[model samples]
Target chain A: MDYFIELFFSGLTRGSIYALIALGYTMVYGIIGLINFAHGEIYMIGAFTALIVSTVLTIYGFPLLAVIVLTALAAVIWAASYGYTIERLAYRPLRSAPRLSPLISAIGMSIFLQNYVLLAQTSDFQPFPALIPEFDFMEPYAHIVGSSDLAILVVSAIVMILLTFMIKFTRTGKAMRATAQDRKMAMLVGINVDNVISITFITGSALAAIGGLLIASHIGQINFYIGFIAGIKAFTAAVLGGIGSIPGAVLGSFILGLTEAFATGYVSSDYEDVFAFSLLVLILIFKPAGLLGKATVEKV
Target chain B: MIFSKRMLSILAAFALAAGIASNASAAETIKIGVAGAHSGDLASYGIPTMKAALLVAQDLNEQGGINGVKVEVLAEDDVCKPEVATNTATKLVSENVNVVIGHICSGATKAALPIYRDANIIVMSPSATNPDLTQSGDYPNFYRTIASDDAQARTLVDFATDTLKVGKIAVIHDKGDYGKGLAEFVKSFLEKDGKAEVVLFEGVTPGAVDYSAVVQKIRRSGADAVIYGGYHPEASKIVSQMRKKRMKTMFLAPDGVKDDTFINVTGKNAEGVYASGPADVSKNPLTKKFRDKFMATEGAEPGAFFDNGVTAALALTNAIAKAGTDSAAIAKVLHTETADTPFGAVKFDETGEPIGIGFVVYQVKDGKFVTVQ
Candidate 1:
């Protein structure tokens, strides 16, 4: 059915955005055991950076391909900077204080960053230019598909694969896993726990920034406070998939996005959010540790 | 050469009394509270509205004040939230303001309506378009420069049926006070006429990035025209997504989607999209000078709601000039008489709705909003 196909494509696109953001939550939670609530703000700032960079590129009349590449690079680099700064300034000092301390600090940083962008930029829903071009292959099926949607799916898939490979094979990835498994033990084994955590933040921030860039291009609208609602949904996805499980986070986002799209398509759009959150509650009741999460024992 | 204690005391008292007399004279100036989302997401609307209020007050003050009272305008940021709106109204009431020009969002206006109603504060909202603002008769002291949401139906129906030749219409709303209210009005308007059948009617959550489901339904229903009842941001997304989905149905919208930002957001896909609003005041002969002054002050081209702001300000100043600062007296004048504005002479109907309303439609052509009707 055309109806089914329509929902599928939209669900995939929406799910990819959620998955990217959820990866940020899962990554930080896995490494530091503290949810980087400000990850959403990093995404927002990244989109802002992309918008500025892309707009300047357009003014300079750069080719579309070069502009897109450079803009993504600029956004990733800037967002990684924000990620590094937030982790160092807000979470690092409070890392050893108490579990609640870093969390509260992350939330405070989220609010602070949101207000900071609000001050720096106009509060209006500024238009984001359409950066991606229509492709020759999808010309006929433009009704059922879009180039941007394809780009979202492909880019997100590649990112996930690369992230998985890095986690599996790379040295820093090994250090990250060691740190996440046991920070004290990893540090004792000369794994450089703080460096691993910082690397996690940078990588997670880069993923979120790309999510921001892609979604901004798809939606063609950006504002200061989009991060809050998005952050909440991604957090939900992280919990639904399995907190601290990277692959689980992506799966949960896809599920969440599919549920919203199908619910809106078949039942009612009014109850779309209801379905997403309700699914979370039902899943939590059935599996407290989430779909792919393992139950951990407290070490004496 | 120290003065005696009594002399010092007398001098201080004399100075204090003199200051008090001057302050009392200053207090005679009429204060109008322009409450809206001056700081948050809706500042695009509120800032322009507030600028118009400020410009009108400045012009009045320069002319030696209105009715021998200099106009003092204070803008409060309600952040477009209901609770904050009520608080803003209460703050304005405490400041002894007799008139409140805004709280631009319909939800915000609804929240603060009862406060102004009970206190007899005249509120001439610039952009709040919910029919409930005046139709309920719960707030006789409230008025607006823009037409009621119901007027949007009246604005779009004729254009949709005759001009666009849309037979089956699909009406979609964002489920907000303004958006849903306008959608209901359009639905009822067409249903009453029995001219065009509404094939698909739906409500959507605003600020959600996806509307593909809604678009697919519209395509399936074979509705020749789709009417969006919401602000430009959501409209832009829906329009862009609809086009991407290859839905060939023509798009028609209420004034909520008339902003230039809509075009920018939708880009090339925005062409041929139709929008309706109550009379383009930009073409009025009186608006040129005002527009020039406004551009100088606001540092950009005026938004769609700019004139709504100026109109609200003019309504207040003219009524206050006639009846002084008593909001009850201003309401009496506002009800019984018409206020001349740059938009034109605006009078209220029995329900305080704007009378002699003229609605027009515009279509986006070559990346510009060109009036078609």
Candidate 2:
């Protein structure tokens, strides 16, 4: 029972991170109808930004709380900017072209960003300083999870709650929903669909940046290629949940994370991904849409 | 038609002149190719070998070169990848390098060896330690200054069973060719020794975001110690995660985890972790000489494979100096003659394994690897 609980929490922690990045993918797909393949690079850039800022701040002997907050702020801003720029430069230009064009551009943008960072910083794995401090209150439960894991869960939950609230209550949220539902109708309704799309990209990128910061600090290292794996997993989560559905993305992420954790725990770690994908294949075969995804009928 | 014929003659004349110029240059200098991961995550391991080759070449040239013929170094980056290594090998061969120093990772070395062998270029590695590289009998021209994984694994198992006295062990690997190969050897050696019972043997997907599930499994298995086989990036992650989870299980690993980067990354979690690396040669005057030279030039202490890099470079040059540019004679000299290296007087056996050079265990103490008695 204790072992089960531990695995459950581990899965939750992993799921929370995947959800953070998956939200980016689902949101971009929701608003612009493009997969934004470079979403993972945004997450990587976020981690790199956090890594640089935190290192310099720590070197200057700042308080841990200050360093953490400022580092996260820098990462979110930089990643969001990169996200905005990618959508503007890569996806926006081809918004009216064939759907495959923007998707290809997204992939090209992903590769371009990866190599850009590789050439700009290094291909080596830079050690990320421990930003989250050990909590004295959590010492008893340390055997099951660490301080960083707890922090990740709490921060992601709060962020998710805020995002949910904004989307449900705010004007921009309505505009985003309207844009996602029918871009032409929304434009006819004076929704300024372009701005809504830009906001969606920025919001998604910011979430991914937060994910990057947490995971990098959690893993204790970052490199140019770290984004690719995390991005792929989160994208899998998005697809598993129904690509354009917000709640579906989160649900898919948690399910994938828990499945991986339990599978690795009970079965063999060798086929961890195998179990995850097999589950995906099984679900897709039955539902055709993701777990929470609405079935869309294409007009013939 | 006459003008076109004259243009053809000019092109042929230029081609012939270029061929003669290249031949004259090839004769004037002995080209040594330094190939390895000068970029990518494993660049730390490969860069030192490149530096070692450069420094050795510099010293040899200053001292009237190899038998009065100047030595030139041609370096290539394999990124420690197998496919890239073949290209690196082909490029070196095309450059007509008389000998090659490295294809650092074992998998890359395995891929690149056929190219070097086909071209009859003797290739020596400072860090590629797969036993199959020597034992497979497929590549006669391959040699390494480091002990093979089997020998290193044996040392680790003996230390765990004899010194640490851990009876139950969990073996983990990154599922790469190198990591899985080393982990398998560790498991078999532990099982054969009968002193320690193998509790769990598993492979983890490299670059997985989290390893908590595996760590929990290790806890549930009730292993007294964990033997990990992989590079520092993954090792640091696992060790740190274990530390975070407050698991104090004894952690032991092979030389792949023995580097300053591991210590730097794992931070406090790195303490008391045992790793078997190339035997300590810090006290050797030759090692001190190279250490000072490297620090003075690069302004940093030599990294993971620096000693073995120096040894491999020294052995290659010494062989070429003794046997001239002939690959067969150089191979024979490498097999028979001893080269004074940082690893002490080193000579390769017929199988291209360094005879006396071996591994010793080191435990991370106060943020550095301290030799274990």
| lDDT (10s digit) by residue, model 1, range B1-373 | 3568889999999978876775575468878889998887778888888888898999999999996678898889999999999999988876667688897999999999899888778888888888788888888887888777677787788789887777999998899877888888899999998889998788888777567766776787889998888889888888889888777789999888988888877888899999986676667754776678887876789875778788888888888888887767887888788887766888776677766455678899999888897
Top lDDT: which candidate number?
A: 2
- Candidate 1 per-residue lDDT over residues A1-300, each given as its tens digit: 867988887687778878878998998898778988999899899999999999999999999999999999999999999999999999998988979888899999999999999999988888898888889899887887689888888888888889889998999989988888878999898887788888899999999899889888888889999888788888999999999998889899899998988887788777889999999999999999889888788889
Native-vs-model 1 lDDT? 0.85
Candidate 1 backbone collisions, by pair: none
Best by TM-score: 2
Which run of 10 residues does model 1 chain B get worst, by summed lDDT?
A: B18-27
Accuracy of chain B in candidate 2 (TM-score): 0.69
Q: Which stretches of candidate 2 lie over 4 Å from their true place?
A: B1-146, B280-341, B345-355
lDDT of 1 at A87: 90
Candidate of highest DockQ: 2
RMSD of 1: 9.5
Which segments of model 1 are wrong by more than 4 Å? B1-146, B282-355
